[model samples]
Target chain A: MLVRVKSRYRPVAMTAAEAMDGRVRRRERNAALLYDAAAELLATRSLDEISVEEICRRAGVGRATFFRIFETKEGLLREFNRRLTADAAARIDAAGDIDLRAALGHVRDAIIEAWGHAGPGHASMALTYAYHAPERIHDPHPELYALVRQRIERAMASGEIPGVVPASLAASLAVINLTAPVAWTLSHRADELDELSGVLLDQWYAGMISTPKPDRRRNGPRP
Target chain B: MLVRVKSRYRPVAMTAAEAMDGRVRRRERNAALLYDAAAELLATRSLDEISVEEICRRAGVGRATFFRIFETKEGLLREFNRRLTADAAARIDAAGDIDLRAALGHVRDAIIEAWGHAGPGHASMALTYAYHAPERIHDPHPELYALVRQRIERAMASGEIPGVVPASLAASLAVINLTAPVAWTLSHRADELDELSGVLLDQWYAGMISTPKPDRRRNGPRP
Candidate 1:
């Protein structure tokens, strides 16, 4: 004989949780659409020329939705910037644990790949604007810095690298040197960014690893 | 015997030339005064916050003279930036023909000294602004880049450096790395700028010279 058991409405609780998850996913999707629209517009227009209305239109979202996600156009742009930095940081993390040379190469490739989404011209301009803002440039991208510091520490501890420089300083130097060429290429040859970036990393890493004495003879007279 | 030929009105001609020279000098003095005043004001305020009237008042010059020297307030700021870069370049040239280490030291010193004129906060802000503007950041500072390139070429040619990197790429790396640290110090700890800059250069240079095998052990763990 089977006893009749009363069944609890567990499906009701599951439905509520699923609804909450669906709401979150919807919000994320809306924000992503807006970000993508802004990036597309920003690729051709300056920040000043971009409007929230146009972004909403391109994103297929209402003005109310846009406002719910972002406070202002500048705020939206800042969000985009933050997202880019975060994505690059994520890439850096993903590329970690490679040998020093491969690690640097992977990191560079990650940055370039992330930047390519915005196109060279837009990426260059965005970086230029961010650099001029009052905020500390490196503070927004702690992951990248941590990656550099970690690489330097590992290289130092294993006696795999020649430099006696502190990890922090070396990391800073690597950040700047590796970045300048990409900026240079963006200004001079956007199409050649990949090639120039490779050249910069190759030459810089070579110099970093090669031991040589300062020559006494090159104090040649200036013209 | 003094031979007095036909009077050629030499005194009158000399007077005209001297008057012209004096007028030019006065104009230059007025412009310099305006620049100094702007620099002082920019130290404490953003460029947008600075007004033409306030600048003229601080400079003790008429607004007309300010306009005469500079088309707009932005123009004045650009000129100021240009002057600072030129001064640094001039110092780099003056410090040329030294040994590899000394040349780098002198160049670094020259750059720091030139930057020292503006309080660190102002200097850092100015650089931040310059980086964002549409104008090319490196164009106005051609001399600085040339100096770096020249040094690298000399070092490479004389076999003073162990690395076989191209001169141009190496130079870009040097410029970016060196400047980034000074900029960092300005915002983070202005008082310790000199000391921090020295450490940065020392470590970076050491890394550039030391030969090390890329360590393969640390690529063991990925976070």
Candidate 2:
């Protein structure tokens, strides 16, 4: 009788813990659904026009559950920004010892792939968040800046790129150069994003380099 | 008595015409004041938060007068956009046959100065219009695109830049590359906007040129 009582209590305790874990997983999944639904709506319509009830209906969650997960639409957007930055940081970290140009290409491909994976609706919302809410993307992600800086430093050490350009400016320029094509593609509904990106990357790679000799005729005399 | 009557009638007719001309001038002046006031407000505030009453108050015009000029806030923004693109087109037209790089620098300086002249408040609103309402700026101004294409073609002809980059892509890339830094500076309130822009431009110029030889060790074998 004593053995049975001890075993029974252990199983009950384990089941309780398991049930709590399962509930957490379910809550997280529901929150993701709500965010995804909100992104879809935001891509097509203005934020002021979207109602919580509509988002709940699309997400297939109860209104109460939506409120439980996100306090407001802005809060939901904040969470999305957080996740996007985290994903970008992870991708940057995963790029092991890649040269600056190739690493830039990798980052660009990863972002383009992410947009494709998110579908057109969510991708559209992502672009707005990127441009309109740059602080959210840049502030909490010093690692991102550091990653770009490190790549530039590595390139500089190897003499692959010029040493005169400031690392910070180079980092900013790299990001700007990569993202501009993506924004254009999304806004224009153009299918040539990858090709456009290739052209940009090639130009960027050649542009940052030093020529062995300066052509005086082409450059003209120095003032 | 007949001579005196004719002289009096001539002065009365002249006075009536002068009064009509003065009224037209006043109307034009009031509309300009209202547009300027709205632009200042929009620079510092989002579109939705600003009221027409506040704009009228700023412009020292009556609400009725404001409505007489612009049917709605959107109408005001549309006018601002039209004028902004027109100003840019005029500036581009005035470049003549200047060298490509110097012309580019001149254009960049002119744009930067215009932003400064607009003041920080109006400049912010202008950036939003440039990106969000591109149709208003670009559609009516093929001259803007033509200006960029002209520069690229000129540069290619002089062998100042690489010929491999398509003129269209080069034009789009140059505009995107230039504008991204401006948008960043405005958003971050960064003090080194000009310095940052110079570095970007220098990097862009160097990157676009043809390299005599690729260092096999650095580039590795092409896949």
Candidate 3:
């Protein structure tokens, strides 16, 4: 009788733990959905105007479910920003092996793809977040920046480039080259991206690696 | 008596016309003030939540004057956008010089200076418009892009650069190089505009003019 009681208690405890784990997993999934819905809603409407109930309705989750997942709307936004930065970092990591030019192209394409996949509302929200919460993205990720600096340093050392452009400057230029197209495209100038990319690459290569032209026509008398 | 009456009426009519012109000019000035105030206020508050009365009060103008100048808030926004674009274009033109690279450097400096002068609120609005209004800046001014293209073509024809790279590509690259730093700066990254300009110039010279180094080692049926 004692053995049977102990076995029953063990099964009950295991079932309760499993049920709790399932609930936590379910909560996390719902929270992600709500965050995504909030981002979409924010694109078209002001953040203050978007209510928790509206998010719950759009996410197909209950109000209790949302409250259980996040403390507030601002909390959800914070999480969204965190996720976006993480996704960008992951994309950069995936593009590790490619040359600077090709890696930049990949970054641009990935951002564009994400924008396309998002609804208009979500895209607008993303833009607002990018503009307003720049600190979130701007905060230096040492690991990412280090990787960028190392790549530039390697390129310079390999004789693919000449002169001593600072690694920090090179990394900044690389990022600028990668990001400008997306900014331009968002402004309804999608046609310019290809042309702009080509121009950027050409100028970057010319400035970094090309030799100076001879000064045949000197201002003063030539010896 | 009839002649005296006619002369008097002429002076009165002229005075009325002058008064009308004065009112128009004052109205225009007030509108500009209101727009500036609205942009400033938007930095702290949501655009939808800010009232016309508050904008007028902040501008030191009256409600009637505000309505007289702008039929609606959206009308004021459109005018503000137009004025800002024109201002940026003028600044870009003012930065022009005989040397293409120097002129480009001036253009970049002008934009950075303007952003500094405009403060965060107005600068943010200008950036948002640039990102949203492609048609406004697209048809590149003949005096700008065309001039750049000609200069690059001249350099190419003279063999200032060793190999043939497309002239159009060269011109576009120059513009993109000038712009990338500004875009990166917008993200509030730690990149100095002057350093970016120098790095761009260095890369352009190296990539376009220098000869490629020959591969040092080759093994083909050596034994």
Candidate 4:
């Protein structure tokens, strides 16, 4: 009984924190490499036609590595969207307590910058993907949706905006207003952005708040 | 010598009215046949997966005949859309001088009815095609777009609405609003046709006339 039994030799299990941290770093690096390649390939061809091999070659990663990170081409596309959406969300979240006009302008400017830097082909691909990927677009990382929704709800609660409209609908409309201009720009009608954004903002604020602007009469002779 | 031409051998072009009528009748017949076949086949397969041969076989038409009528599968799909859009346009146009709310309600009712009559599978296929089609949802049909734009512009002119939001944006939004709800419905969501239609009408009117409603306050409140 005094003698200790010899234990079998075994590898020690990694701590949960260590495992998670390593996994997270690996995922982030792989995703960055994939996106860099995707952005480059997208610049030359439409998304529908771009093959996984091309992306892998461009990223200087093997097929196995690519597959280890992304399940499919669409998965890679979603990753790219996730990053951009997160960036935009961060910017929007940072500008807390701003006026509606200024806040919306900030959102609009961020969206424009994102779209502009996305380059023409990548922008078109992202738009086309968004159009076809309804489920993805609606829930492309629900955390972002939740954050945006909470911010909008908080704004509504502040009475800076007046609306009985459901928070979800208002969020959806804000999204539509922000993205619709990009859809037009993707079609090469870039000149329409300023005018379209103005119209959209006016409609959103005036319609939602039911605020009567005295200048309405100035737009035309009262109909 | 030319006077010796036989009456039976001479080719005769139909008059403009007669030709147009005949063309319409032919189109109607072909569409009915194709629609029936498509509805039946779509129960088990997608439009992309279905072949021209299969569509023709199901329709009891020859491959050549199918091609003669529809240049491609996309063309056939477009024809189906054209029928639906035309029907919607006719209904909307008939409700002349109706307020934006009523007119939109009528259009919604018509669309719901049309969708109701379609088999669930066919409705799904149509939605998929509409989403993926090259043309943005409403623009492919100039006639429909023009009619919708005119109605929006008229609504704005009526001073019942107060802003200069482009008629085009209003028209596009109207189409998207109507389509989005129905598209959502197809997925078996917590949506009733009448309720969704009502929300859409409310949003459209609010957006169009810059009318502030209680719901607008529910959007993010200004800090």
Instruction: Tell me, by lDDT, which candidate is best.
Output: 2
Compared with the true structure, what per-residue lDDT tens digits does model 4 show for residues B40-154?
Answer: 7766666767888887787777777677766777554454434543454455566664432233233333333444344434544544543332234442233334444555565
Put down candidate 2 lDDT per residue, B17-136, tens digits, no spaces: 787877666777887778777767766676567888998999999999888777766566445434433333344456654332222223223323333344334434433443333222
Docking class of 2: incorrect
Backbone N/Cα/C clashes per model = 2, 3, 19, 19
TM-score of each: 0.41, 0.37, 0.31, 0.43
True contacts kept of each: 0.04, 0.14, 0.15, 0.10
A88-178: candidate 3 lDDT, tens digit per residue: 3345466564333332232233322333344444433333443333222212222333434555676666666653555665665543443
Residue A143's C-alpha lDDT in candidate 2? 36
**Which residue segments of model 2 deviate by more than 4 Å?**
A1-29, A32-61, A68-87, A118-223, B1-29, B33-62, B68-87, B98-107, B118-223
Q: How should the candidates be ordered by lDDT, best one leading?
A: 2, 4, 1, 3
Write one digit per residue (lDDT tens) for candidate 3, span B1-223: 0000111101223445787877666766776677778867866555556788898888999998888766776554445434433443344355442232222222233223333333334434434543232222212222233444555666666666543444654554444443344334434443444444444544654555554323311111111
Off by over 4 Å in 3: A1-26, A33-60, A67-106, A112-223, B1-20, B28-223
TM-score rank order:
4, 1, 2, 3
Model 2, span A105-161: residue lDDT tens = 332333233333343344333334433433332332233344445566767776767
Maximum-TM-score candidate? 4
Question: Mind giving the per-residue lDDT tens digits that candidate 4 earns over A1-223?
Answer: 0001111113345566787777666666666777777777776677778888888887777788778777766565455434433443445457764432233233223333344354445645644543333333433223323433554676677775644555666565554554454344334434544445445645654455554333321111211
Of 2 and 4, the candidate ranking higher by lDDT: 2
Each model's DockQ? 0.05, 0.07, 0.07, 0.07
Whichever of 3 and 4 has more TM-score, that candidate is 4
C-alpha RMSD between model 4 and the true structure: 19.8
**Model 3 error, position B221 (Å):** 64
Q: Write the residue-wise lDDT of candidate 1 on A1-223 in tens digits.
A: 0001111112323445787877666777887778778778776776667778888999998888888877666455455434433443344456654332222222223223333344433544444454332224333234344545555666666666655344666666654544444334333433443334434344445545554333311111211
Residue B189 alpha-carbon offset, candidate 2, angstroms: 35
